[model samples]
Target: MKVAVSVLGLAAIAAAHGYHEEDQTPIEGPHNALWYNTLPGDGGTQADSVFSGISTFGRIQYHPCLTSRSVKYDIAFIGAPFDTGTSYRPGARFGPSGIRQGSRRLNLYLPLCSRRVGFSGGYNVPLKANPFNSWAKVIDCGDIPVTSYDNGYALQQIEDGHNLLLSRAPYTDADKPGPAKKDRTLPRLITLGGDHTITLPLLRSINREYGPVSVIHFDSHLDTWKPKVFGGSPSQQASINHGTYFFHAAQEGLLANDSNIHAGIRTTLSGPSDYENDGYCGFQIVEAREIDKIGTDGIIKKIRERVGTEKPVYLSIDIDTLDPAFAPATGTPETGGWTTRELRTIIRGLEGINLIAADIVEVAPAYDTNAELTTMAAADTLYEVMTLMVKKGPLSGMKEKEERLELKA
Candidate 1:
């Protein structure tokens, strides 16, 4: 995937030399203070260009806990902060904090022009112009608070929080009596993630609101295994377990078209007939070797065709989808898998599609060293998605300007 460069001219200069400087400015101001560090100097045109009058990065203002409307954002960043569903390494619950701490260093202003052309030998195209200049808004609502002991309750809380954001509450008549009533748009929930299973509840809530949602699930395992069957009633235990999310989703009628739920499944452990029957049930299964054979563009095209352009898409990325060489510490690292670049290419290709929400899950920081690869990859992916959102409009304006400049030349 082509990594879009940050707009700060100074960082461009610094990056040329392979060093990322940490900006130490306090974040108590209106916008994130780290953004100011990307400037050419302490005070420069680059700094002014990226941070001028931008009160916040995304929906998250500095010191979010102190804010009254806790859910104040077009996009909310809730953390599941749990890994109880993992069939393997038990530390993915720490993923949210680790990713957050690592991501705090990001400036969040991606200049579309910085994207490298011909990244996939012309398979991928750069945005026609820079979108950051167009003023699209995003907010980082605080992470969802999860209790350590009760996984089921924690999952319910996550669903409740997302529902609050998704539900449109009436504007208080006491504040402003209205002969005129306007429906407030609910925030688009972007979860930081606890485990892959955390997605089940989030998906359930989304399905309730919008009907079946098309899922683009990226993972090493099939996650379609049926949890061990118990007497009479199906156990809720298996319903929300990490490995069985997709299976449960399918069984529960949460998926619009089973084919729309493309599973980029590479690794696996065999269990029941249901697990093996995923491909039969309409999932567009793209195995690891298939990704290697056809490349990112092929897989992206397949996804686009299956999901279609108009449908609201939900992206769920399990950190283990990446090759262990690049993201070694994920709960279930497969030996061979897609490179981080490949994943980015696939994500970038979905630029114009209606992406309602996304999440990066199952990152176990305890298994990582330096936390360098996973952090960098996760942050870059978020930037790419945000840029995609911007490029759909404001960023396109910049592209138009670039075209005019080229014509003049």
Candidate 2:
């Protein structure tokens, strides 16, 4: 009798719902004029039919979701199409397209539950009055326009292009009279990778505008090696090279102090000298072995102590941080590293903290055969981070307690 009532209730609800043609489109509603419109019914204004047809690419509407009101967006998916900083393979430039292609296979639902939640439970949530109703607004703001060569200039161009997309308020003559106050207002820009080096300029821009920002760097190497190959040239292989981004960031005064950066460093190939005299000054390093010892909880606690509760945090993930068994196609793969589950735990633990911006770097698809592991992991990680951003108001420890109760139940 209860089962029959449930079926009848579901049928009644379905009958009462009015299904519109726009509901079938990827982007389903009104948005800011500047956002990309990929929904099939969007009247071909923003993206061409071919680009709009793919689910991975969608329109961005400007509105308040997490941050303040200033060109606010649900989410912006950007592609960084270059890899000049790679030390081994020369194919990470293709990473953005490959990852996007792989992302197309993702269902617009959390993998754990079949409900629509936008690439895992990262964006969809229930309204207070209606638990059954879930909504999410996401956009593919298009790729970070980049060239194939002149990496130094390319990095600058990528940063400028991203800035243009991220810029909310244009400066008019009236607004330009006084010195521009550091505008803390910007979109929660979620960037895809050309290589890990691409993160350098983005981080710089974020820090310049928002002041001191905490960092959660997930990678195999420390990326703290001072660039010696390019002889101080402004090439991507110089200060912003994949291997030396954080090192230079610290040197350039982007990170506040040692305590502001938490290097979730797993695999390593550097000598002892790399640690003693590296430019990372006093940054904290969480080795994989230590993570095995103290557990993810302990690592989270340590990160909290270092980064503190107040500052806005940035998460930069180099896909190579995962063990080769899990992410083998990355340009730099290390044997001993976090598993996918372990990595997820670390991200899940950081919930409720101020996540200002994030990026997933170093996904070299040219080396990937099945396209199963690296890109999937990238998508999952991106989902988890974005979800944390949306639900940032909730306390981290409180969420953990609730999870424990659910498990017991």
Candidate 3:
């Protein structure tokens, strides 16, 4: 009787939640939801069909499920909407929504109609190149339901949610390998930010998968300040904060500090100890002004040298890494930053960094202008990350030497 009742209850719940598509097509996509979804149901305006088809990235479908029994996922995009950790500004809670909204207006193809830089296809239905199939399964898992009434609980919830995704299998049986293996091999996580503080919890979850991964952080601030909670300060107790989580993560052995590096740092220091604090936390600094001296290729060479192709890596991009002229909607804006194209080229140069996971953070839409360049840059940056994950080979020769080894093997 209990088993029968349980089945009935589950069936009822699924029925209540299922989309009752009467004549809706069962399939769509060149990029999984691309071409077929464009025409959605017959007899609608172009605008209507575009918006109504798929509500996620560039008309991609929204998929909120993350269970072993469900279809495996290669990449899962989700949002973290809590920004109580912000020290200077607080509107980043809207970052994820802003990014998604901006992405809908952007095309998925390399140049909207060519595959020279990316995949070959028209703007509406983008295709992928050889070995990096456009058919790769990416699911938008939706936002973590963080209400922010309790900060600690909210942080833990984010960590738990991330761990849950990392622990599951990708949709392909080949990706999973063995039926007995509890977790899949190559599925990755792309997170849209609540704030930089989310990185600490995210790293904690990832540590369980590949211990102490080297980090390639692109930010305008060092983010290694010590929290007031340390040393048992007589003032009110402090918690893990955006400005201080990297310090804690390093102290807790959560990062391969010696191998980690920060790019585009230009924030004013509180004291001489600020740079020292960052050094102690285990990161090499690449100042924003250094870009002019070293140029894009120099910066790429330095990053590849610091985070060699051997170890697993994580990329944390704060929107402020781009100059305010390019991305002005971040909470902590800093001057003298890289251009969006420069950043894109640098990221592209890191084709074989063994990137395990990544997140684009600190995009506050409230501060943006009607142009929406800040959020749009964040969306474009996310696209660069996806390309980095799914690319086949270098554009020309002069590839990283380690890649030659990979090809030979």
Q: What is the descending TM-score order?
A: 3, 2, 1
Model 1 lDDT, residue 37, Cα:
36
lDDT of 1 by residue, 1-409 (tens): 1222434454466467543333212122333443333323332122222334433323134334213444344344666777887767788777776676555434534332322210101001354423222334455556667776777888887777666655432211212221112312233556777788888888878776666778888887777665663112266764567877777788888776764654456664445554457664347667777886788888888888888755566788887888888887788778778888888788888877766677888888888878567855765566566666555442223334445667999
Candidate 2 deviation (Cα RMSD): 9.9
**lDDT of model 3 at position 352:** 74
- Candidate 3 residue 14 C-alpha distance from true site, Å: 44
RMSD of each: 10.6, 9.9, 12.7
lDDT of each: 0.61, 0.61, 0.71
- 247, model 3: CA deviation in Å? 0.9
How do all models score by TM-score? Answer: 0.71, 0.71, 0.77
Backbone clashes for every candidate come to: 12, 0, 4
Put down candidate 3 lDDT per residue, 1-409, tens digits, no spaces: 6644654554465346541234112222344323222122422111223334455654455776543336456677888887888878888889988898777654433212111112212121122332223546666787877767776788888888888887666554434232112332646788999899899889988887667879999999888877763333233224577877788789889899699999988988767777886788779998888888889989999999999976678999999999999998998898889999998888877877777789999999999999989988998778777766655222111123435667999
- Candidate 3 off by > 4 Å: 1-54, 66-69, 108-135, 173-184, 229-237, 392-409
For model 2, residues 1-409, the per-residue Cα lDDT tens digits are 6644654554455346532223322322222353442222334222222234443522223232223324434346777787888877667777776666665434332211111111221232221111012232355665766887687788887777666655543212212211112422344578889888888888767655566566877877777776763236465445567877777777777776766544456545446666565434557777767787898888778777877655567788888878888887798788787888788777777765767678888888877767468877787677677666556532233334445667999
Regarding lDDT, does 1 or 3 come out ahead? Answer: 3
How close to the true structure is residue 369 of candidate 2, measured as C-alpha lDDT? 65
Evaluate model 1: give its lDDT: 0.61
